[model samples]
Target: MKESEFIKKNSVFWRKLKKELKRSGPLTCRDTFPDDYEKVCYQIGLSRQRGYNLELIDSLDSLALRMRQELYRKPSLSLHNLLYQFLVETPRVIRGNFSYVLAALFLFTLPAIATYFILLKQPHLAFVLIDPANIEHIEDMYRDNAPHLGAPADVDSRVMMFGYYIKNNIGIDFSCFAGGILVGIGSIFFLVFNGFFLGTIFGHLENQGLGYNLSLFVVSHAPMELMALVFSGAAGMKMGFSFLIPGPYTRLHSLRKSSLIGVKFLILAAIMTFVAAAIEAYWSSLPHLDMQSRVIFSLSNVLLIGAYVGLLGWKRGPI
Candidate 1:
């Protein structure tokens, strides 16, 4: 295309970009900035090749530079940035995949309910999913007067358990996300398996008169850990959905785009999982935290998380 025609074709886009760059959180879609940046760079090259005027070349080059900085500059790790990421960006990303979240919730909750009722009717059925040895261990761990719950009494043991919790939690989260590669079936399986497993444990505990003890131990961390799994399951389903449908783009491109979005979902999942692991290893197992205190803390966390995700996510933040 002639330089004049090319300029005419893209001037509107450039103007929009300029406007967006002036906005507080510039870049309408941060991920899409690369495509826009590359296009601008290509335009600069084309103008130079066509022997366009120096004024126009310089103008395009300047715009390209602005875009490049936006695309590649290291974001500051300021408090404001962190707050915005957690309060605004993370929730926005999650809400965008709300349908997938609903799907994940359905898969998880339904199985849990089913298994819980089934195990209540015949507690022995818990052995189907949980090993007999593990059931015995769980019974001892949640005994009414148990000293440490699942945690050990020593500081070193607690530290080791902290690390182990993080490792184990993250591993589960990664599995929830990576399972999308099996066309979402793997993700579904994992969610159902976990939900059923939990129900099995809960049912068996209640049967053994350890329900209150079990709740006291898990309440502090359950909200965050469950949220993390839900996020990861949604992320997995999203990737699988994109690959399965591919709408307008090629299968590969669709997969690539969804996977990028999935990575953001996993970011939230990882943050929640890490928090849950910390609480489980330390706060949940703390000997001094009474049942009422644990419930209060857990309730506060749930309210905060729900408000942030439900309220902040639904509305645009100042940042």
Candidate 2:
């Protein structure tokens, strides 16, 4: 094969090597280029001597002898570098754990618990806990009874109900996830208390025949709200688990490593919570659905939550 034709076929490889040679003097041909060296030289058809002569012809005489030595260059993968350095590295820290999951459940149950005892034994406390003035603007709408337009009368009520559900439910979800930092117990307490409250509230609503209304309001936003909160709690629980099971690392190291698993979820949950709020605010309030429809919608929301958790509910790899 002609020198020029050989050069054309291996132009890219040769150009790169030539540039490296210019920056760092050429290698000697006698010292076998690491095992891979011959591949580069043979491909170019410029035997080490021919290359050395060519370098000399190009006015780089001093590099000729050095160029005779075959050189082996390390190859790199930019795709791998980019992915490993950023995306893959991030998820390593943000994982899920049993503790976080439990905590989230506990926190979500708080409302149910409060709704229980207070609904019967201490009815006043239920009123207080569910509509605590301590919570910002907890009684704002009830107190104001502000008029709403552009929707049916029931629509506004449904919307308000959905909003209330999201606000109340999302708060507990956040608590469950956040509480995981307390080594799972925090999350546990959060879940138990919240779940209890929710159960009790529904119980009370059921007795009053308003359960259907509540169910309808809940369906539209609950999917997003519940998932977001669960994710947050899962993150915290993962952190707690890290600390508890340090494995090869020190307690602090393990905790730091594990804590990273839930970060993306935490961020996503916060944003979803807000979207849920908007849905409650604008769409869910228009009470267009009847009782059966409401029940179906609520079930759909529950199903959606189940599916999402199933998809991203566990840790599959080492942190």
Candidate 3:
């Protein structure tokens, strides 16, 4: 069939799909979505195969991409919905916005690595990024005879520590995310500052021969906790980038759209931080876990979290 005939035949279907795609309300089951999606996919391939006009091909391509974004973006609240969100939507969003996440990771880790090495060479300079008074406290916490970073305490004390962890880390996460309003400067500063701050502590402890205790204290929760930073930082950058490249939308509209996505990343960060707090309070604080055990536990965390974000929900469906 000719291109015009092909379009004329499917005009009603394309129009209906376009209307559904532009709906502002929650997407419900029309039971025709799968067929609509598959047909659109076929039309796209057919258009390209037949060397149709660029406009026809572009419209179909854009529609397909938006459909992919919305495929698992349901707003229902149920046990099944929650499971689906975690197993599918979360990873999909991560993969979709993964470049920002990588940028966040790079901005965070590069400074950390640089600071750790610099401080290791010149241990006295730790006071630049770390507080002078706090250095002694850290030494006391990780001293040879009394390593106390995550020292065992009563159940009540552990609960308090858990609360403290949540409060502090989430505060940082929020700052990293909210800083997007400042065109991402705030997020970058916080990530870089925190990196240097933590690196200073690590290098200073290592210099003082207290690295062993610190390793055991942080290993188990570090992966998830650090990923919270990545998520929030990336979210903020996403929001900030809206102003720089609003694309076809108005500035406010683009910001609103990007902020919605940013909030999803923040939610992921919050959940991970909660779990990190639990680990830090209960498991990481447990005394006498061997170095080998700590290493293994941390490795497992890395593998699990990495695989979940990198592997699951990987394929972009036609929807």
For candidate 1, the TM-score is 0.73
What do the candidate models score in CA lDDT, each in turn?
Answer: 0.85, 0.57, 0.85
Q: Which residue runs of candidate 2 sit more than 4 Å off their true CA positions?
A: 1-103, 110-176, 196-200, 203-209, 309-319
Q: Best to worst by TM-score, what's the order?
A: 3, 1, 2
The TM-scores, one per candidate, come to 0.73, 0.50, 0.73
Error of 3 at 76 (Å): 6.3
- Across 1-319, the per-residue lDDT of candidate 1 in tens digits comes to 7778877998999998888777766473578888888888888888889899899899888888777777776866889887777778778888787999989988998888888888889987988788899899988888866767744477777788889989998899999999987788878888999999888888889888888889989999999999889889999989998999999999999999998889888988898899898898778888777889999999998997788677874566557
Q: Write the per-residue lDDT of candidate 3 for residues 81-144, one digit (tens) a residue.
A: 7776777777888889989999999999998889889988898898877778889887887775
- Among all windows of 10 consecutive residues in model 2, the one with the lowest summed lDDT is 141-150
**Native-to-model Cα distance after best TM-score fit, residue 246 in candidate 3, in Å:** 1.2
**lDDT per residue (tens digit) for residues 171-289 in model 2:** 76666667777776776565565566566565555554455555655667666766666667667777777788888999998877766566555655666787777766665555455
